[model samples]
Target: MNPGVADAALEGGSAPVGPRRGRLGRPSWPLTILMIAASLTVLVPLYFTIVMAFKSPAQIGSGSGLEFPSPIVWDNFARAWEMVGFGRSLMVTALITVFSVAGAIVVCSMVAYAIARNWHRRAYKVAYIYLLSGLFVPFTVLILPLIKLTAMLGIDGPVGVTLIHIVGGIAFNSLLYIAFLRSIPLELEESARIDGATTWQVFWRVIFPLLGPMNATVGIFAFLGAWNDFLLPQMMIANPELQTLPVVQQLFQGEFNTEYNLAFASYLMAMVPTLIAFVFAQKWVMSGVMRGAIK
Candidate 1:
């Protein structure tokens, strides 16, 4: 054989190249620009929110909105806090978020586990498809019926709101959970069963613990959804005193007047918890998504 051919054969068919196949390609400028633009859509509003939140009523009208507050007034937050009944509304929102997150994780995980394990069975398969079907239906289409039903059931309050959040999240959360569950080996459960563990024990001990990443992803989503929900709490919680933070924040805006500074202050406050949740859980969420996609 020729020396060149021999060298090529020994070098896995290609001995030299301009760029190695394993090396990453150059960054796509257009994609990078698009992503930056998309991110600015979020960051710009946030910037304005922080600016408006700190601006005094005088500073707000005196100059462009991009200008920072000269004195850095903290009174907007205080005034918004008082006007919106921030303490009570915060408590109500927190409770609803906590319950909604917990319920979504537990219920959706269990349902996903059952469907995934018994996918060959007709009943479970039908139920799985039915649950997924909910994803196609818009929430607004059901709001009127939901309102009437909750009223009839005498749960048209925070309790009803929390319940609806949990139920509404079932479809999407279960899809994530089921996809992640597929990546888990059935051998683990079988081993647990061989050690005298019942199906329930096998799940709670062997399976549930392994679902930490996906749980974080689902929990964060549920927390954000429940916390940021405005329409449901606004329409359902009949008593003004029992309304959620988003609903109570409406006090800063009306037909004839709007307190931009105070409204932004309240908006900033309401979004802080969600920001914290996402910041902490983002890693787990990415890992869960990657793992689920692998299967």
Candidate 2:
């Protein structure tokens, strides 16, 4: 081979090399600009709400919303606590959240397992359809009947409200669990049966371990739902001492219309635990959502 000719051919004749900037393939500046713009739209309002939560009533009324507080009113949190009865509301809210999440996880998982494991069975097919039908039936239509039934059962106050939250969870929670269970391979389950394991053993020892991430996702969703519920608690529990966070937060706002800072300070406190849980559960939630979307 001729060395000069071979080298020229290998470099594709090296004709008129252009500027290096265009060849570098820089990322689209337009898309980055849009994303930053969209994020600011949401974050700016949230940032103002947070600053207002920490401000004194006079400062909140007079100061510019975008600017930092002249004097940070840290005492708003303490005043907000007593104003909202944070101690009692916190206990009731915690109780409702825990019980509702626990019930939803156990009940929904079992229902999902049964449906997914026996999907070919005619009975299960019918039942699954029946449950899916409830998905479109809005909860507003059912609340009237629910209130009457609760009244008949002498079920009132925080515990009664908690049960209602769990019952209302059946539609969406079961759907998520069922979709996740469907994604799991049946071969693992069938092999367990062949090893002389009972149905409960197959579920508890085999399929249950794989459900951890999905369960975390479901529990976080259920807890957030229960924690933020308002009207259900109001109708079921008229007693001030038994009220949950959102319900009492409303009452706080209505009673103290002039004190926006104090009311918001208390509301933000109620939101803290839920926000923390979501931060931790975000990874599991992404996993669960992906599992459901798989073909």
Candidate 3:
């Protein structure tokens, strides 16, 4: 054999190089530019809000909305904090969100595990369909009845609102968990069972820990929903002291007029906690979203 031919054969035959193409068979630059523009569009409003949050009332009224404040004023935050009862509202919102997310994760994960494990059973299929049906029933349709029921039960405040969040969140979160759970191998649970672990022990020891990503995804979603929710908290709890952050922030708005600066300040304050949380848990959230998408 010719030495050149042998070398070419050894190298598996030279293939012509081509420009890289993205999944859509297009050059990547256009997509990159499009994505950058889309991100800027979304961030622009948030940037405006942050700028307004630090501006004095005078500067907000006279200066361009997009321009940075001269001699940045921290008093807007202080005033907004006091006016909105940020300390109290933060605590109320946190409590409700924490309980609601925890309850939803626990209840939905357990139900999802059971359903995934027992999917071969007709009864389990029926049960899964029944639970999933909750997803179609819009919460607005049930709000009036929920209010009446909660009032009668004497639990119409934060507790009632927390329960509502948990119940409302379960269907969707359960679906995510179920999808992910179905992808988990049953051999792990079976091995635990063979070692004399009861069903509950196998779930707690072997199954639940593997669900961390989905749990983070669901928890972030639940927290954001419950924290930003206004209608339910507004309707269920009329007590001024018990209002959540979104509900309390509305106090800055009036029928005929509004305090734009303070309202923006309050809005920024309300957003910071959730933003920080998402920043921290973004990796897990992305993983869970990808896993859910694949399954």
Q: Which lDDT tens digits does candidate 2 get at residues 156-184?
A: 77778888887787877788888668768
lDDT of each: 0.84, 0.78, 0.83
Task: Give me the runs in candidate 3 sitting further than 4 Å from their true place.
Answer: 1-38, 120-122, 255-258, 293-295
Each prediction's RMSD over C-alphas, in Å, is 8.8, 11.6, 9.5
Best by TM-score: 3
Better of 1 and 2 by lDDT: 1
Q: State TM-scores per candidate.
A: 0.80, 0.80, 0.82
Give the CA lDDT, 0 to 100, for residue 290 in model 1: 42
What lDDT, from 0 to 1, does candidate 3 have? 0.83
lDDT of 3 by residue, 141-217 (tens): 99999999999999999999999999997788899898778768988888889899999999899999998878877
lDDT of 1 by residue, 1-295 (tens): 4656544443432223223567687878999999999999889888988998998888888888888788798998898889888999999988999999999999999999999999999999999989999999999999999999999999999999999999998988899889779879999999889899998998899999999878977876787689889999998988888899888877866886557888889889988876776678665555444443333
